[model samples]
Target: MACLKLDARALNGLWNADHWERELSDPRRICVGIAEGSDNLSAVACGWIVLDELQITVVAVDPEHRRQGLGRTVLKQLLLDASSAGARQAFLDVAEDNHGALALYGALGFHTIGRRSGYYRNGKDALIQSLELQTDIKLN
Candidate 1:
């Protein structure tokens, strides 16, 4: 749920991270399926963006809300939003152990562009992937 997102506590800090917000602040930035009205307060994806470069900082659905397709919906929205913005591409770093996440990005047209060794606090590595955007299609 939104409450369980790593950025949950930093919700307020969003205003301070306004450089990204300045460009991502469109009320219609993206369509968040099941973004609200979940049984719990969150049951949604927690994300951020810089132009078309979207970041899936955290996405936690309430146990009660699992398997309902909310997670994928949120991811789709983030990708669409970034593509609609100006991002020539979008990138995310997923822990090597997170097979599900890797699959999601792969299914969404993201490709592993690089890797960061010991990128996690627990010494886990990370896969950095990106989705290239068509500049001609980017909106102002």
Candidate 2:
């Protein structure tokens, strides 16, 4: 729901967003999302962003909430926020088999900027995409 706007089930155990909470507490990496609701405190669309480059590192929505456009909403807001704060480029990596994710990123004005071969644990390829920073990058 954040980086790639993907669902938790689809993501399987490929990632652990909570484990990153401590890492994101740092100023360099950003994490943002809506609370999961009363008592959970866990968030929907937990995203990891590289503030300096506006790169999206991770994002996932709980399986129960899939297809609600929450993923898109979160991703869009993050990009907008990055732009507002000043970022000329947003980058990300995705498993090549994730066609849906590729499509969403394309719709968001992100384009393939590079590739890292043999990069996945399963030996699948990884596509590196980038969203051009339309505005000058500035992080104050």
Summed over model 2, clashes come to 3
State which candidate has the highest TM-score.
Answer: 2
What's the CA error at residue 46 for candidate 2, in Å?
A: 6.2
Assess every candidate by TM-score: 0.63, 0.73
Predict model 1's lDDT versus the native. 0.57
Question: On a 0 to 1 TM-score scale, where does candidate 1 land against the true structure?
Answer: 0.63
For 3-82, candidate 1 gives per-residue lDDT tens digits of: 43313442332323453344245543342435454533433343556654666554444445656666666666665665
Clashing pairs in 2: 1-60, 3-59, 88-133
> What C-alpha lDDT values do all the predictions have?
0.57, 0.62
For candidate 1, which ten residues in a row score worst on lDDT?
Answer: 6-15
Candidate 2 wrong stretches, greater than 4 Å: 1-10, 15-19, 39-52, 135-140
The residue-by-residue lDDT of candidate 2 on 1-140, one tens digit each, is 24222323446556566655444566655555654543332233333445457767665655666567666666776776766676657888988888877877777777787789999888888999887767422222
